[model samples]
Target: MTAARDDHTRWEELAAGYALSALEPADEEAFLGHLPGCEVCAELIADAREVMAGLASTAPAVEPPASLRDAIVAAATPRAGLPPSPRQPRRRETRRSRYAAVAVVAAVVLIVVLGVWNVALQLQDRGQEHRLAAAERVMACVEQPGCRAIPLAAAKGGQVPVTALVRGREVSLVADGLPPNDTTGTTYVLWQKTGAADPSPVAAFDVTRDGVAVIDAGRLTDPLGTTEWLAVSHETGREPPAAPSEPVALGTVS
Candidate 1:
């Protein structure tokens, strides 16, 4: 019961900002781990996600500078811990390793969401630069081998580009131009197809506006090469929903 109470308190303090990617890496990961079983947090995340989408519509479109990747890598590289010189007075300090900084931000978006950017800016004003760097690092890793970008589209609806990174059965997916579903009892789900076998639900999520959303990376793990195309479907709340039944968008796994 204490643990549950603690989770609620934490949610009240940071859930919205966490959804906006405003927390430190550790905090963000912790929140994500807590999301699945906590319906309250899930509902809150849905609300925050909608806020993110609305901001996306008003944000500027800018290509990340070529140096951004290098900057991220440089930021993520570890440095040795050196003791203070004998001549200086020493004080205690707590530190975390650099590898911890590069866990991956998980999404690609030419248009940065203003609301999210504002939340990050608030952190910056408070001197939390390292926190915001996580997203940049994730974007940097997207250029690495195994991960590729492709468009997720439908003949009669809106579409977006997804940046996908699959390692063994796990995947890291982030999308640009993602919007949320507001229809009652309905949500968006992700499916992965293998050869001729039916597509299986790999991830499930909903968006409120137009922005970028990173579907649960853990849900992405599937037998590597066997996974063919990826599709998004609208369905009743059941996840991996027996079947997409009706696909909203589909794309080849490149």
Candidate 2:
């Protein structure tokens, strides 16, 4: 099909709908043809398609009868040009047939609802799997030899109970009663001080309002047992600082 050359504005307006596969056939064909030559249009369409693909996994899937589609179309458009309606089935015992039709409609609704519920459960299960993996890391550290449960109490304030689980270099901290703060430009920096030597910076992480943080500070430069003190400090994000500043919370590292 020959592609019509529309102006940039028109193309941009149609790009998202085409990417989402919601555009009608003629528009889809024309936009697809235009996409190859226009770099800007191609990139935006690619991004939109990716967003739609990701959204598909989260949204419930239900294919209603074709009549539903037709009804929506008929409701939106002018009625003058509509074709004559086809005759619907007429039953001799109208009362009983109406009851049967109602039963069938209820069944279809239930099936659609159950299908959506199943999809929701699957998505939730995937999320739980990730959380469980994080939890297992902490559990493994606790169960390992030379594992240390370090207390992370705030130095200058009424502290919420926080504990760091460490085995070798792997570390995960779980804290409670965390303050709700905008994490936009802030992070929790971990510090390791080996005896009197300068405190060294390790991993940086963020916590939600619920005070939950599972940071994999990665492997420590020094071996697990060598560090004398482990601490966490609230600092500006982007990158971790070189030296340990003041501690938001601190505990002995054994």
Top-lDDT candidate index: 2
What range of 10 consecutive residues in model 1 has the weakest lDDT sum? Answer: 90-99
Residue 95 miss distance in model 2 (angstroms): 17
- What's model 1's overall lDDT? 0.54
Q: Give per-residue CA lDDT, model 1, range 1-254, as digits (tens).
A: 43554346454334544554556667668877777777655655565466546546767434344333333334333346865323321111101111122121113222233445776677555433432343453555566666444455773665554545555566655655545676566677777888888778787777654555565456553675676787777787645567777666777864
Please provide, for model 2 over 158-238, each residue's C-alpha lDDT reduced to its tens digit, 9 standing for 90 to 100.
Answer: 864466787767677766554543578877788888866888878877776453445566766687668888888878764
**Candidate 2 off by > 4 Å:** 1-82, 85-127, 151-163, 169-184, 206-213, 223-226, 242-248
> Backbone collision count in every prediction?
6, 0
lDDT on C-alpha atoms for all candidate structures: 0.54, 0.61
Off by over 4 Å in 1: 1-138, 155-161
Clashing pairs in 2: none
Which numbered prediction scores highest in TM-score against the true structure? 2
TM-score of each: 0.41, 0.44
